[model samples]
Target: MSPQARRDQLIALGLAMVGERPLEQVSIDAIAEEAGVSRALLFHYFDSKQDFHVAIARAQAEAMLECTAPEESLGDPLRILTASMSAFVDFVTDNRSAYMALIRGAASADPAMREVFDHTRSVMAGRVLDHAPALEIEPTPVVEMTVHGWIAFVEQTTISWLTDPLITRDELLAVISSALPALASAVGAVLPTAP
Candidate 1:
């Protein structure tokens, strides 16, 4: 493989392993063997195992962002929010172990992993802020803080839902979809009806 292809191959191998186990437990030796390369060759692509895991975490972050992005083609803000939340829940459910690892890794002391985590949260929060006007959510400082808080709330709630999914998927979706709009209502903005 070319140099970039080799690097991407190693990262893909690591990301697959991440889906099965926690990030810290993703064995570099196992990945190298799976890639048909030496551990030293793997190291050529990454400074260390943590660095490789960081790359995996970055990929995971990007995947979540891509999957959870609102379908602006849906037009109505409420409908867009519902589609985004549904997509987010489905992505997490499909990648449960890996998503948990990403959450745990973000909570770790690793700065690089934390940066990836923070950026993901920022983009997710930004989406809500970007659609604030349509949602009738005032994009004030307090609204910005509320949006970030709601993102954090959804993350923790989804993690809990993964642990014990007593609630039906649609119920979970309803709660997440309606939450920010309710918060906007609390702040004097009228919540738009979902189409």
Candidate 2:
């Protein structure tokens, strides 16, 4: 297999095993055995466990992007946001383990893992900018900060929902919907008056 393809396979294998375990419990050996490759080969593909984690981060970001795709082009901004949140909740529910690992590891001390964590949020920020242009006020840094905060909120809430399935998708959707006005207000507050 090509290097990229092999890397994807290893990432998928890692994601599969991570399905609900904490980040610390997961090991390179487990991922290597799961991928049917030796530890050396795994290391060859990725410089370290942290590097392999960057692969997983990109994969998770890709998955999130996929989930957002369907609702991204909707005519109504509110509907688009609602659909995205519902999709987000569903993805987290379906990939609880992987989601947990991705979130936790990205927040950890490893620099490589942290980069993925930051990059993944940045990818999501671009999407938010597209969806909520009002947030573009106050220059790029402010916009990015606001977008990152929104991403963090989404990630935190989704994880909370996963901890208790009793929180139905509709309930989460309602909460997300309720936030739209506040998000709009904040975005609008920062934006300058149109000429």
Candidate 3:
């Protein structure tokens, strides 16, 4: 495999393992083993475990952006918002383990990784506006914080749902959908007349 291919393989393997276990419990040797590469090669690719963690976080961010990128301008605000939520839930459900490990590790250990989390939050907020251009709200630090908080809340909720299989998808969607009004209100955006 080419160098880039090997790197991709390493990242893919890392994501797979995160689903299997928590990040703290995951080992470099194990990652190397799963990637079918030498520990030394893994080290060569990433200077340290921390560096590798950052790389994985970056890859995840890119993957998420690709997944949620609007194919066309979803002209309707509510439709766009609901579509985004659906995509988000699907992403979390499909990559539950990886998202858990990434969130846990980024929140605790990696500054760079945390930045990726922040960027994702901004994108989430931007998605809101993209779907509803007439929100009549100005971009401000407060808006950013609100968006960030909403993203974090959704992620945490999704994490809990992933851990507890009892939460049905519709139930999760209903709970999340019900909260959109509050989220929009907090961010100073106008909510639609009805659900």
Q: Quick one: best TM-score, which candidate?
A: 1
Q: Give the runs in model 3 whose Cα sits over 4 Å from its true position.
A: 71-73, 136-141, 165-167, 186-195
Q: Give the per-residue lDDT digits (tens) of candidate 3, residues 73-190.
A: 7765565666677888898778776776667655665677788776776777786555444555444556556666667777888888877757798888767756755766755644
What is the C-alpha lDDT profile of model 2 across 18-88, one tens digit per residue?
66575556689998887788999999988888777767766876786788664645777667767777788
Quality of model 3 by C-alpha lDDT: 0.72
Cα lDDT tens digits, model 1, 1-195, are: 899999988888888887888878899999989998899998888999889988998888899999988898999989999999999999999888778877887688999889988889889989999999886556877788888889988989888998899899999999988988878777664434322
TM-score of each: 0.94, 0.80, 0.81
User: Cα-based RMSD of the predictions, in order?
Assistant: 3.9, 3.4, 4.3
User: What lDDT is obtained when candidate 1 is compared to the true structure?
Assistant: 0.86
TM-score of the candidate numbered 3?
Answer: 0.81
Best by lDDT: 1
Global fold similarity of model 2 (TM-score)? 0.80
